[model samples]
Every structure is written in structure tokens, then in C-alpha cells.
Target: MTQESQAAEANASGNDNLLLQAAAPLLNAVVQLRQAVTHDDPAGLRQSLIDEIRQFEQRCKQAGLPFEMIIGARYCLCSALDEAAAQTPWGTRGVWSGNGMLVTFHNESWGGEKFFQLLSRISQSPNQHLWLLEVVHYCLLLGYEGRYRGSDSGRVQCDAIRKRLAKLIEETRQPQSESARPLVEVHPLVSSISRPMIPLWACATVAALLACLLYSALNWRLGNDAEPLLRAIYQTPLPQITVGRRPSSPQALLDLRQRLNDVIAAGQLEVSDGAFGSKVIIPADKLFAEQGTAINPVGRALLARVATAMKNVKGTVLVSVFTDNRPVDNSRFASSYEFSFARARAVTQLLQSQLADGHAIRSEGRGDSDPLLPNDSNENRTRNRRVEITLFAAPETLSNHQGTQ
Candidate 1:
């Protein structure tokens, strides 16, 4: 195959692999959720909900997706739903708001009939289908609605997800055939008298109920010293990808080390052999402007050299950025993680721009979560603010070597 074609094929394969990886956990979570709801076990339902959301959050991070986890929202509580709805008076609605990604759940009333109806809708609605697609989109390394940029694993993953979304969008837009009901259809109102609002005094009826639920939720969380879980109907997790044996044959390992050494010798970065692979650290002061994601001229030059050195390696490169625990509230970034992610993405873009083929590169922002040094000292905090790049043999490359052996 021509070099370009080979690169294209490798990228497409990687994309599919990542998507399938993310989907595995999600499918399992969905099944568990469906089972919990079907059996009417509220405790199991709540636990499953937490497990699934945590998985989604982790998968999004691993896959390099953009959506943030709303940790403060009490997602699995029926009380949150009731309170949100009760405020509306005439029936009620619950919407996944804040982020432009809106998820609307149809729970007209919190009665026995509505409970069963909600369960039925979740199991058999286009809304659920659309929701799955959205989760996958957000789980993708690419931002939602991103296009295929070509010849990279991350781009390929984005491409595959975009295609899936296109198919879903089309399916959602087309007129429903006779066999398939519209996912969400307006119900016919039989009579106005049949649908009556709760009396104003009835608001008092829920006051005690709401207070009890709030107290219980707070106590449960405070007792455990854990964050309260939110009660939302959307979100899920993807499965983990199994890594192959490391391709660290003595000769190859030596060659890779020598290349890293050559760069380290130039004084632009630091390199050390890590447990899993070779770790390359580039100081943020060198790669980025103060509080910026844009690469400086010096940063671009260093990345170009690193990319050139790594172009022929049959491996994937993970470029992740880390930041100190300093508060980022006054800045444009909403959180430290967002700031770190932007810097990582900026570095990845520069590296990819210089690379021609063979090296598979992706980026992640770890935020202030994984600090390398104690944050108590300014020098230590400064040490924590750096970008780390690591190299690992692609699974296919390792598999091919084993096959030859």
C-alpha cells in the first residue's frame, strides 16, 4: 500500500477499536439499568445509576471526550424529579440543562401510572436511542459534531462517531413508517376536566415529603463522606480496552531510548524510561504562554523535533498535560482540568501537524487531579505544571511481531 493509504487504514482501524471499547461498558450499563428498573428494585436502580455514570465519566476521560461530569447534581433521586416537577404545578417536566446538550425526560406526573409509562418509554423510545448516540458522541475523543481530520487514531475515532451520529440524525428526522411509532408523540387530550392541577394547599402535602428526602440524602452522603449522586435518566459507561504485551524487545527498546536520549541531550525536554513506556516531560513554561493553550514559537520548534524523532516508531503517543492545584475560578476556564486539557490539546495539535505517519498521537488533560509533587510549596507546584508525553507500541504492532515469531 502507498504510505498515505497505509496511514489511512491504520487510523480507521484505531478509530473503530476505540469506539468499540467505549461502547462495551455503555451496553453493559444499559442492560443493568434496564434490569434494575424492570425488577422495581429502587436501591439496585440507584446503585446501577451511580456505577453507570462513573463509568461514563471515566470513559469520556480515557477517550478524550469534552462533556464534564456534573458531580453536584443528585442524579438518581426520585425526590429531585418530584421537586423539579412540583414547582411546575400543572403536571411537570425534568430537563438535563446547563450544558447545551439537553436531555428531556417525560414524566408528566409521579404517580404509579406515570412510573410504568416512564419505564416503558425508556425501554422502547427513540429518545433512548438518541440518548445512546449522544453518549457515544461525547465519549469520542473528538468533540461532539467533529469531522474526520484524517490519518490519526483520535481523528478516526471522531470520524466513526460522526458517521454513527449522522445515521441516527437521519433516522430521527425521517417520517416514521407505519410500523414504527414516532419516538415522542403528543398525546391526545381526552378532556380538560380530567387533567386538574393540584390544589394550592396540596403544595403543603409535598413539603414534608421533600424535606424528609433532602434530610435523608444529606445524611447518607455526610455519613459516608462522599458526594451525593444525582438522579438523571441519561448517561452510561464504555468498556475497557485490553492492552497487548508491550513491544519492548531489547533492540527496539534500546533504539527507542537512544532516540529519546538524543532529544534530552538537546536540553529541550526530559526523558526517562517509565514502567510502562518511555516518559517525556516538557515544561509548560516552554510549551505554552502563561494561562494559554496556544503554542509559542519555541514550543512549536520543540514539538517539531520530537515529532520528527517519533515519526517512524510503531507506537501510540499519549500527550497529557498536568497543572497545579491553584484555583482557576477567575480565569476563562471553568476548572483546572479544563485548563490542563486545553494545553494538552494544543500540544497534540502541534505534534500532529509535524508528524507525517506511523506515530499515533492522542492528548489528555489530567487537570490538578494527579499532582507529581506536594502543592504546599511554590517550587513544588511549579514542578507539577508540566506536559507529559509517553510512548507505547501499538497493539497491532505487538501482535504482528508475535505472529512472526
Candidate 2:
């Protein structure tokens, strides 16, 4: 064989080596995951799956393979884990609540199976890299389940993942030549009609139609119709819309919730939608240093940032604070309720001072009433003690409904 053939064979062998390096760990992970599932050990299953993912990631980096391969493999592994989770008892498949506590996975069935199917289509196609990048993005968004979205550390990790995926996509993108279309000979009868008999008249008629459209558009832009038209076009802060005589929160609030989710997810907070409005759940420990109403420096800074986020929200801010099941000494505060109430009041004061337009701020203290996680461990107790601030667009409906009674 010639030197050129030898070189081609060597390159093909190197490609095979890389492929095996990436696939071997994934295959082993799958086998171990299946074994864990067969034994019905949720903890073991979760651990093994995560281990395999890490191993695969390491192997990919070492092999210098494209990120799309890793992403595709990750999707498959996560799907397998989800399936195994289905077979396990519902209570056993727990989520790692960013604060070291294990919380119940709220929606176990929302891992984008349909979206994954669409992604799988790119496996054999030349554009697999681009499509897999999209898959990575979709998976990242899915990982933002209600529980993890409140974690600050979680947000940072997600941002890092996004940056890495973007870099990989940029590196892997391929340029394609535009496909050339075959020219066809025009049919004689159609060709004869194509050259308009009154060319000037045709042009004049088209120009006249364009002028009418331009005049109508200008009139709409300059008149009372402009505001509504523009609002329809660039609807950012979505105004409230009526649905069957019931008014819903504006789209702006929904968008605001997403924005808040992104920010608070980076920190040790969680964002959720409640009946009243959107809410941010902050751990009580983070807010107050051991057993005191005085806000710590960290807590104050966090609240200040939260206040800034809420400044534009035209709604009532409700700061509901709670304590864990542990008993507090009545010497410092009369009762747990009082301590919680005091904490809420302090936060409310800060928000009220910052919020523009004199937005109403409501403070509630429910001592040990709600427990997010079972108070089994110190971590669980820490998670249980939290302050949830809920924001509603407007309280007019609430007031009106109360007035009739």
C-alpha cells in the first residue's frame, strides 16, 4: 500500500479509538444503571447514573471529541434514569434541593420525551452538531424544574454549561453551499402572457396599491390607533387580558417570574407561582445568623437585591416568614410566631422603602406551620425555616370581592 493509503488508515483507526473511548463509559453506565434498577435501589441508581455521566464527560474531554456526542449520550442516560425512576417508588426518587436537603421531585414526568425524539433525528444527519447543541439547550431548560430554579449555585453551574455548549457549537458548525436549482424553459403560451401587453399600466397599478397601503399605515401610526398597534407589535410587559370575565395577571408578571427564576436560581432561593402571584423562597438561616431577628450582612445584601428586582413590579408584596419545628427560647422573643413576625416586618420595611409608587407590603409570620422538607436532619430543618415573598400585580379584585361580603 502507498503512504497516502497508510495515512488514511491511521486516521480512521484514530477516529475509531475516540469513538470507543466515548462509548465505553456510557455503555458501562447503562449496564450499572440497569443493575441498580433491577435491585430497586433508588439511591444506588441515582449515584451510579451520575457517576456514569461524569465518566462519560471525562472520557469525551480526554478524547477531544465534539460536545454534541456527549450531549446526545447524556440525553440517553437521563432518559434511562427517568425510566428507572418510574419503576421505583414515587417517594424514593428524590430531588437534591440545592441546600443539601432532599425534596420530593414535583413533576417526574416532564423530561421532554417528544423534544428528545425530534433531537434523535439528527443522529445520522450531517447537521448533528448544530441540532445536538439545540438539544443541550432544551435539556438545560428542562433541568430548571421548579425546585432547582431557586438555587444560586445551581444557576451558576447552568450558566457554565451553556457557555461550554455554545463554544462547542461555534467550533463544530459547518458551512454549506446553497443548492442550485435547475432552470426550465418557459412554456410558449405562458411566456407570451408573462411579458405584459401594457407594461407601464401594470407598474402604475402596482405603485397605486403600494401608495394606498403606505397611506393607511401612516394614518394609523400618527393617530389614536398607534398605541394599540404598537402595543400589539412589541408587547413586552404583557398587560392583563380578560378571559371569560375573569382577569389574569399580566404577561409581564409571567415574564418577570422567569427573570426572577434565572437570578434567584443562582442563589440559595427558589421561585414559584402561587395563587396570589409569583414568589421567591429564601432560606431563613441565610437571612438571620443563629437565632436572632437582626439581619446579617449576607441577608441584607440578598434582600436589597430582591428589592431591586421587585421595584418595577406593580403589585402588593407579601413577606411571609416561618420557622422550623425546633423550639425557640421565649426569653429573646415571646414566641416563634413573634420571632417570625418580627423577621417578616424587618424585610417588609426594607422592601416598602425601596418599592416605588407606594406599593402595599403585607407581612405574615406562621411559625413552623409549613415544612418544605421532613425535619429529619439539620439540613432539612434549615430548609424548613424559610421566608417566602409573594408578589401580585394588583389587589383590586381581592378588595372588590371582599367588599361584597
Candidate 3:
């Protein structure tokens, strides 16, 4: 395949990964809880599942958001989550980007508690499929050979579940005209309300309910401990972003995406469309030696290729560096923020000499504050440690600090 095709494929795959990460927690929980369905004494597993679900709920609290986690139900908790989505790590755009998912379940099998924790991870990625949880759950019921497959976990093997699956398949095969009721139900998120209410009370009701929902969902008051979880979301990917002043057109974003893909190695970097024009994500390891400010030889070579690619592209170039939520124990810089800023400046310097004078560049240091994923595992931490360079379509966006330093 061509380099551009490869880049497109990688971006699609990366977004899928973002969705999978979001869906894993709640999906695992629900799938596990479903496993307990076969046990004569499921209380043990049920209680354990509750504890895990509660942990995710607490983490949401740590993020300063309260969401409903229905323990066991057969329908998607769509609107409840839609309302709580804004306070989520990725916001509403992060929530699978599907207006209505789970439209193809074809049966009463539901994705609930076990899948809720994963919902946030799914939201973290762009253009995510909302139906992933349902697909995973449906496959589990069919005895699919995957981790979430219910057969391996003992839930799908029981005579009752087997009989139920057989019946579901038979019903799914029936012609819609011959069936008494439609096999598919529209997911609640996109389904219209049954009745109308006054707009005035809706605002007051939402305001009143938010407090009660948070209090009821969390039960006890938060102590002084959850402070570290709530940090400001990084907003300066572009220098000064004013709405309609960017991206000459949607086609402009597409062309920029293709151009970057031609020069940057697909495996080495990530390329995608952004609110600006195009955004490229490169791992810090690819750009710098460990704990050093200067760009390594390999990094310099990659940046050189990037500079050559955008030589004629006129736009605002921003080099934003981020650090994982780890202490800068032995680094020369005092903290992660300083270290990130220093690297951004170093990378920006390399690109300035090669690009045309019309292209403006600025460096931004976004410490451990803005992360794509929670800094929980070594793999996650590594993913969070990276650099972002955004090329805004609008020219002359930066008025100050054009290229000082």
C-alpha cells in the first residue's frame, strides 16, 4: 500500500485502540458478571463485580464527575451517560462518536455495569463505534473465542444460556413481516422522548438533579485526597484558536493529513485531522535521548523530513510536549512541566530554520496534566509521554513570539 494509505489505516487503527481502551473496564465487568449467571450461588461473583464497578465509580469521582452505574440491566444506559459525558476525560466527542450504538443487538442481552468502566476509554478516541460493547457482549453469548467470550468464563456453557442463545438465533432469522414484534430496539440515546416537557423546568430539573445524582452516586463526601485527579485540560494545541478563523475548508484538513503522511513514517508517528488542520503525534523517545534536552541524531533526521514536507505549507506550527504523570526524579529540569517546555523549544528550533518564514511556530509545555490515557500502567505511561505538532490552516495565528529563542 502507499504511504498515505498506510497512514490512514494507522489513524483508523489508533482510534479503534482508543475506543477499546475505553470499553475494556465496563465490558470486562459486565462480561464477568454475566459469567456469574451460570452459578447456583452467584452472590460471591456478583459482590466482587460490584466492588470493581464501585472502584470505577470512585475513579470517575476522582475525575470530578458522577455517573450512574446500574448493577444489572438489559438496556444501554444511554442518556444518563450522555449527560455525564462532558465531565469525562475526553468529553462528549470521546464517547464512541456514535449517536446511537447497540442498534443491532437483536435480543434482550444487555451491556451494563461491567462495560461502564470501559465507556470512558472508548470516549478517549475519536470516531469510535458506540456499539463495540454490544458487539463484544453479543459475541460472548455466541461463545466467541475472545477474552470477553462468556463460554471460556463458564456463563455461556450452561444449558439455560445455550437454550436462550438458540432461541435468540431462531428469532433473529425470522422475517420482520412475520414476527409479532420488531427484533431491534433503537438505543435510548437517540430514541425520542415519549412526552414533552417545558424548557424552563428542564433547566431547573437538570440543575437540581445534578447535585442529587452526584451525592447519591458517591454517597460519602469527598475528602482532601482526590485533588491530584482533577487537573486542567490542556487547551493550547494551537496558539490562539478562534472558531471560524481556521481550516480554510474541510478539504484543506484532508489534504494536510495526506501531505504529512507522505513524509512522516506511519509506524514512527501518528497523523490525524484536528480542529486546527492536521496533528502529528511523536513519542518523546523517538525525538530525544533519555532525560536530555537536545534532539538526538535520529530525531533530527525525522524532524528534517517533516520540515521538508511543510516547506510550502503556510500555517501556524505548534510544538507541544507532554510528560507522563511520573516524578522527574533524576532529570536536570526541576519538574515535568519545565522538562516538557524545554523539549518543545528544542524541537521547535530544529523546524524553524527549514520552514518558510510565513509559517509561525510556538512551543507549549503540558506536563502530566493532559494525558490521552490514565497514567496507570507502564504501557499507558509510555503512551502518554509524547510530543504533538499541530499545523493550523489559518495563517498568522500567532502575533507574539513568532520565533524568538
Candidate 4:
């Protein structure tokens, strides 16, 4: 066979296997349900029905089928069967739905006949035929209404069963043996009949005894001293607090900033000075266009710090990076400063991709307009060719700050 034909056959075989596996549980449920009903125990039948439904649901999941549909089908079937069982011989000829069952006993156009005609065909002895009929009724209900009405139908069937049970109880009478029992039996006498009630407070004695017992129980369960000694053995220590001092001076800020910068620098990211601040720039052509060049250690480290800073920063901030500017590079930027902006944008994209909430970050690139220095000397030009980041107050912050100002 051709390769494509072989692959198709393999896929079909796999599907068949899955179906076979799923069928086992469903079959087991059906068997259990049958056994429960055969025993004539309503409680057992109900439990078995629940188990069967649960098994069917599990099978659906295993077969990668929609579990809800299976459940719906079961519900519809059960409801229909219940409705059929509850109806009198005359009431059996009807269609059932969420609203109610419709009975059509005699209608010339619709082959007018009492619905009891169907139930009358089944033999009353052994109850198996009735049980089988119930199952068939459920199946018919499922076929007519589909899975959508299963849940409602199932609930209705359960309610009908409960009603039937109540009616059964009302119709039942106690057996002769049970009803003929004596009202009370006399105990063997101990011979002495002495009554001693000298105190007038004897009536209140019972109330006092009950109050004492109640108080003791309350103290045992809720009183602090009555707490179990085992609990004290597993007690944990109180948590410790470590307060951090805030950086005040520009030097302190610079020191902390340097420490953070060192982590990014260690990663070996491309760095440059910009109009506002020193920045880490990612080479877009190397990182994006050509995926071969992996993000260097420096880029990863910088990304990490940027992610950390993002969490604490109350206002919206933009991170921009720059790459080497080429005159022939008609993408966007012409100068090094413009290239720096692109680099910053690349870094911003990287950060956003890494962080789950990165969509909240606002990012942009300014080609070469804002430069660190005059692009005259090579050294100055290199310094100018850099990414820039600025913190802009969030709208809420801006409004609050403006109000305060």
C-alpha cells in the first residue's frame, strides 16, 4: 500500500481501539443497572443508575467524546422511562417533553387508539418484561427528544418515582401478624413499690441536673483550658519581620542602579548611552530577522531586571533599544540613535513575550531624534547611538498628581 493509505488505515485502527476501550465501562454500567432492578430494590436501582451515568461520562471522556451529550442522552432516556412507568394503562400513549407529557388515547387521523395498547402486550409476571419495557421507553424518549432535554427529563422521572413510592405506601396495609401485636408488655415485678417525696424542690432537681450536664459539655468543646494538648506539640514559631531601608540620595540610587546594571551587563547585552539614560539594546536583525543568534547572557539578565522593575513601577514606562544604523537599511531608522530605538523596541517585545501581563506595557521607538550627544565624533556618535527608557506617569497617577499639584 502507498504511504498515505497506510497512515489513514493506522489512524482508523487507533480510533477503533479507543471506542472499544470506552465501551467496556458503559457495558458494565448496564449490567449493574439490570442486576439492581432484578433485586426489586429502589435504592439499589437508583444508586446503580447514578453509577452507570457516571461510568458513561467517564467513557465519553476516554473516547474524546463530549461528556455532556452522553449525560443528556441518559437523562432523556431515564425521564421517558419514568413517565411511561408512572402512567396508568390509558396514560401510556403520549409524547413527553420538558413541559409535560401529551396523551393521545383516541384519534382517528393519528391511528386513534388508547396508548395502553402497547403496555397491554407485555406479560405482567416476573417483572422482567416491565423492566425491559421501561428501558425501551427510555431509549425511545432519547431518540425523540435528543440529549438536550435529558437533565430535565431525568429530574421529572425521579420525582415521578418518588410520587409512585408515596402512593405505594398509602395503598399498602400492615400484615395481620404485625397488626395483631400487643400494645405493651409487662415486666417481671421486683416486689417493692416505695414512693418517697419529702422535698418540694424535687421537681426542679431534674432541671438542675440537665443544666450541669450542658455546662460541662460546653466547657469541654469551647473552653480554652480544655483544648487538646496534642495541638500545642505541633505549634509553629511566629514569623520574623525584616525591614528594608529606602534609598534617599542620588548616590544611593546610583549604587542600587549599578548593581542592577551589573546583572544585565553580566549577561553580555549590547549597551549604549541615550538622551535620557544608559540602556540595553537588542539587535533586531540578529534576534528577529535571523533567529540563529540567540539572546546573549546580557539580554536575558536585562530582561529579568526589566520584568522585576515592571512589577514595582507604579507608572507606565517605555523601554527602547537601538541597533547599528545603516544608510542602506530602509526599514526605519537612518542614524544610530534611531537604530537604538528599534533595539529598545525589540527588548520591549522580548519582555512582553516573557511576562504574562506584558500587554499592559506601553512601548515605542524614536529613530534618531533624541540623541545622547552630537553625532559628530565617533565616540560621541557611539554614545548617542543607544536605547532610551522613560517613566511616564500612568493616567490615574497623572490625574492624581495633577490634582495634588
Candidate 5:
């Protein structure tokens, strides 16, 4: 052989070696991607798939082969991965079109025999479109057989495989001479392969940014100044009511009760002797009636607890305060219900201050209408001059209709 022929052979061998080396990584990436998908790691799988596509494209470029073939392979692999991840059982014996456009697989009873029968029909067909379909069919059958049985026994099988491969190679080759337009348009393939990754990355970035923003907002809202309020809310002072019968799944009710207890405990709210057992009593003087004192420590503590309890509690917690009528100078009751209502409204305002979101509080006072005992005695009157908290079940609950009192 001439020196030129030896150099050409050496270059060809080098090119072949490069192609093989490039293909190894590309093939390994595909396998890793499949494994990632099987393990249910979508992020890992997506990244691996993207890397495989990039590597395959790069290798195809280096080998002087049309990247369209690699693109077609990527498309098929992606389709298969998607189907597998979705748990769709794809049959082994089938025909997949050149562009992975359509797939026809052998169902039960239709095996190699049926595949050969279809091939015979295609061979007899006159139409070019039918002939192409036949070629696709044979190619798919060859792939299927290779994948499953690992055999190529039939006389026509080897020929079919060669023809199908040749056809793909021919389609991939760029025209020697340029016409009005480019022979092979690869821009679409590049765009089609890369377009999905952009959106995936963008969505991931947006989600991460949103998560950070939400965390920051929460931290800022619950800073140092809110500690006293939160503490007062969490440990309220209240008498424990060990009701003989409690609901089977009283988690929601218990949470509310605990929060109220925390507030009562922290505030050290004292109850005046009389009324049904020991109920909390707020002195009218230290209440909202005093211009400077919007809410006493006890009242503030109670309000904080109410706010926290209501956070998880679904229903409305009605709070009402009543004032003493027997005072010699009863100027505060000149407006009667209105003065009492103002006190309730003031408590609601304190509760609102502790809440994160702007929530409306429903409150009303009926003067001394629903007194627990007669106002004849000082002790009985003290009981009447107090705030009452009633927890009504949510409107949506079926048991809410039952009378609690």
C-alpha cells in the first residue's frame, strides 16, 4: 500500500476510536437516567437525560455524522422513559416509526408469525407509503427481537436489518451539492431537544426563590417584639375542666382549650367568688374604660391566648364583658350596652394586634342581661361584672347545631 493509503487508514482508525469512546459516555448516561427514573428521582433522571442528549449531540458532531440520528434516538429514549415511569407496559414485539411518530406492537397471540405476515403484505404492496411503513415495521421487529429473544434466525431478518440501517444512514447524510434550501435542517432538532430544559430550570429557580421569600417573611413577622405576646398566648392561666365525656377525636377542641389555658396561666387572671364555679373577673376601673390603659396585662394575656387558639380553631369565640350597675356614680352605664360593648371591642382590638393576618373579630355585649346570679349580694354582683368566653363549634360541623348551654 502507498504511504497516502496508510495515513488515510490510520486517520480512519483514529476517527472510529473517537466515535466509540464518545458513544460509551452517551450510552452510560442513558442507562444512568433510566436507573434514576426507576428509583423515582425525577431531578436526577431529568439532569442525566439532558446530559446524555448534550453528549450524544457532541459525539455525532465529532464523528461527522448527522446529529439528527442522535436526536431521533433521544426522542425514542425519552418516550420510553416517560412510559416506563408512568407504569405503562410497552410490548417488546412492535414497530416504531423512523421519527418515533407511531408504534404498533404485538399483543397476545400475535407473535413472530403475525410480524412475518405483516412483512409479506408490505412486500406485495405497490404504494411507496405502504413500502415505507413496511420498512418501519421490519425495523421495529428487528429491534424487538434483538431486545427480547436475542436472536436473528429468520432468512429475511438479517437483510431487513441491513436495509433499515442503510435507510437511516441515507436519511442522515447531507447532500453533496446545495439546492435552494439546506439539504438537512438540524435547527429544529436542536431546538426541540433543548426547549424543555429551559422551562424546567426556570420553574425550579422560581420555586426556590418563592420558598426563600416565604421563610424570610415568616421570620420577620415572628421577631423579638412578638416574644412576650407569644409567651403570654402559649401559657394562659385557666382552671382545668376534666369533663367526664370528651369527643373521641378532640384534637381541635383540645388545642383550643390548651391555648386558652396557657393565656389564663401566664396572665394570672383572678376570678371573683360566686357565679358557676370559679370564673375570671375584670375590674371595670382597670378595663378599657381607663383612657391610657387599652388592655391590662391580664386582658392582654387573655387576648393573646384567644388569638393563638383561634388560629387553629375553626369557629367563632364570642367574648362579652358586663359592668356593675349598683355603683353610686353609674355614669359609665348611661349608655348601658354601648359601654359594655366598647369593652368587648377593646379586647377584640388587643386580640387582632397579636394575629399575623388581618382577621375580623366578632364581639358583642348585652350589658348585664345574661347574669349568672341575682345582683342582690356584692359577691353575686362581682360575678355579673365580668367577661364571659363561649366557644361555639364551626358552622360546618354537624354537632354544632346541638345546644352547648
Candidate 6:
């Protein structure tokens, strides 16, 4: 083998060894997970597994291993429980909370401090963050009660984080094109091994004979089968495609638009009614607490006026917050997406009450993504940090009534 091929093989072997080492601590946990999936855990097993995980994490950190490998493995187990429940022969699967004591995959606090630590390591490798995302998703899925739990707003935030982690994994998982490495010439003796060649004309004649026989056989069989096949085809029903409804024109919402105009004029807000949809944009600094997620008094008053004006609007209320591409170090918010989500939820909660009958409040946190302007200058970044509220109707509906997978 060439030196280049040898080096490549060695590198691959090293990576496999490291992954195996990281997964070593979870041997006992996997056994426990099997029992948990069957709902057959023995007494005291829960606390014992939790302690093992906690110690394993501490050791991983102290030893400076990829900090998130353990987290990812535990999450993989939890996800396994969900899959089992889904595939159960017994009726509809309710919530799958069989993750045992690994609710957040840690005995540690599921508060801001721990989350901040996780967020601080966003600069770490994708392998690291995949593990962190596993933990974050645990907080959302495992019936853990917190500010961002069991709420539409929290789900939206978790979804944003999930999307980010997915993208990271996808980017890193791509097969890298190896650069051409210089190779040494092989010996003539090694290269001389060869197979005898067949005559092309003889091979072609054999192939043609076989093809003719196969074609005759097919023709005979098809002659017998053709009538039945054609009959079945003619009797088969055509599929019906469902045409979707489009959004009504903005002219229908002119009265509501005019009412929202006064609120737009009073605050640092922008309004646009276009072919896509009608949206109200409020600057984040004007609508939220400085470097915080809570809506300030001014923002509250402004949103309150908006809610009052749109009380009669009949549709799902869409609230989305976009933050600038800036790293955050606050005690409350660990990342810009979390910050955006919290504010979006705050706005969503305030506006929910005024929603018309059957109207639901949905919020999203698009952090430093899909920016309104490039973050080249401070002014541009500021322009990108904004909140959008849409009086959603049929067109703005991302999915149908049951939601698309």
C-alpha cells in the first residue's frame, strides 16, 4: 500500500477508536435503557443510572474528551424509547417518557447557568454540539417543567435549535474530497498480474444469442399476460390531487391594516402588505428589555394597542423574532436563538388573549438567520434585529390543519 493510503487508514482507525472510547461509559446505561423501553425497570435502578451518567460527564469534562459524546448517546437511547412506542402494536402511542432519570440527561440543574455553559461552547466542534443538542431536546421532550416547556413558544425555540444542529451535522457529515497525495511507483512484478481477455466478437455473439432467447421467452409470456394487465390498468382509479387555497388579497384587510397603521406610526415599527402577506415589524430594542427577553413597558403598550386593533382578525397569529449575528454572554440567554425565542413567546403570550375564536398563537426564533440586512455595520445589524407579527391566514399557513411532517 502507498503511504497516502496507509495514513488515511490510520486516521480512520483513530476516529473509530475515539468514538468507541466515548461510548464506553454508556455500556450499563444501554442495558438500563432496554429495560426502560419495556417498562420493566427494577427498584433503585433510576438513581443508580443517573449517578453513573453524572460521574461520566464530570470525567469527560476533566479529561477534556469531546464533551458532548455522552450527551448524544443518552439522547439516542431516549429517542429509541420513542421509536419503540411509535411502533407498538397497541393503539396510538401517547407520550414516551421512558427515558428514566435521564430527563435532561443530567442530575445537574436545567436552568440558565447550565444552558449558558452549553451555549458558550457553541464555538466547539459539531461533534460537541450534537451532544449538547441532545440535552437541549431532552429539556423540551422529557416532561421537564420549565419556562420553555409544554408551550408553543418553547417548541418553536427548540425547533430552531434542532434545525441548526441538523444543518451542522449535515455540513460535517459530507464525504470530504481527499486531495491528491504524491505516490511512489509500484514494482513491475506487482503490476504484472493480469487476467486473460476474451475475443470481443465471440463474446458479442454469445450475448446476442442469450438476448434473443430471453426476448422470445418474454414475448411469449407477455402475449399471455397482456390482456389482464391492460384490463387492470383500465380499471385502476386515477389519483386525485388536492389543490391548496391561496391567501385572499390585502384589499380585504385594508381596514385592519389602517388600524395597525396608527400603532406603526407611534413606535419604531414598519408595515408592509404585499403578495406574500401583511406583516408588522418592530425593532427589538424598542420592543424588548435591553439585552433581555422580556418585553418592556413601551413594547407592551405598543403590542397591546396592536392586539386591541386586531382583536377581530380571524386567523392564527404568527409571531417571529430575528436577532443580529452577535454572540451573547448574558446570564439569562445562552444564545441569540434562545433570546429571540423568549421574546417571541413573550409577545405571543400577550397577544393570545385577543385572538379571535379558534385562532392559535405560533412563534419562531430565527436567530442571526434570514437577516433583513447584512451585519456589515452596527446600523445594519440593528436593522436586522426585529420582531414580525403576521395576521396569518390560509397562504401564510406553513402546513395544513394537521401539520405536515
Q: Identify the candidate with maximal lDDT.
A: 2
What candidate 2 gets wrong by more than 4 Å, as runs, is 1-251, 395-405
Could you tell me which residue pairs clash in candidate 6?
Answer: none
- Model 3, 55-162: lDDT tens digits are 544443343322321211112322222222222333323222222122111011122322433333333331222234333333333232221222244443333433
lDDT of 6 at 92: 17
**TM-scores for all predictions:** 0.43, 0.36, 0.38, 0.26, 0.30, 0.42
Clashes (candidate 5): 9
- Tens digits of per-residue lDDT for model 4, 26-105: 33333233233223444444445456555654555554543323322333334443343323232222322111211110
Report the lDDT tens digits of candidate 2 across residue range 38-138: 45444554566566666766666565555445545454445434533443344233442110011011111223332234233442353545534444443
TM-score (C-alpha) between model 5 and the true structure: 0.30
Please identify which of the two predictions, 4 or 6, would achieve the higher lDDT against the true structure: 6
List lDDT for all candidates, in order: 0.49, 0.53, 0.49, 0.37, 0.41, 0.52
Residue by residue across 23-61, what tens digits does model 1's lDDT show? 444333333332332343444433554465456545544
Task: Estimate the TM-score for candidate 6.
Answer: 0.42
The TM-score, computed over Cα atoms with residue i paired to residue i, of candidate 1 is 0.43
Clash count list over all predictions: 11, 6, 14, 14, 9, 0
TM-score winner between 2 and 4, please give it.
Answer: 2
Ranking by lDDT: 2, 6, 1, 3, 5, 4
lDDT of 5 by residue, 307-352 (tens): 6655644444456676554422333333334456567767656755
Compared with the true structure, the alpha-carbon lDDT of candidate 5 equals 0.41
After the best TM-score superposition of candidate 6, give how far the Cα of residue 98 lies from its true spot, in angstroms: 21
The true-versus-predicted C-alpha distance at residue 101 of model 4, in Å, is: 60
Clash pairs, candidate 5, are 235-262, 236-261, 236-262, 236-263, 236-264, 236-265, 237-263, 237-264, 237-265
lDDT of 6 by residue, 6-81 (tens): 3234334323233333434444244334334344333244456556655655555444544234444443433333
After superposition, candidate 4 runs with Cα above 4 Å error: 1-261, 264-297, 322-342, 355-359, 393-405
How far is 395's C-alpha from truth in model 1 (Å)? 3.4
Q: lDDT of candidate 2?
A: 0.53
- The candidate with the higher TM-score, 1 or 3, is 1
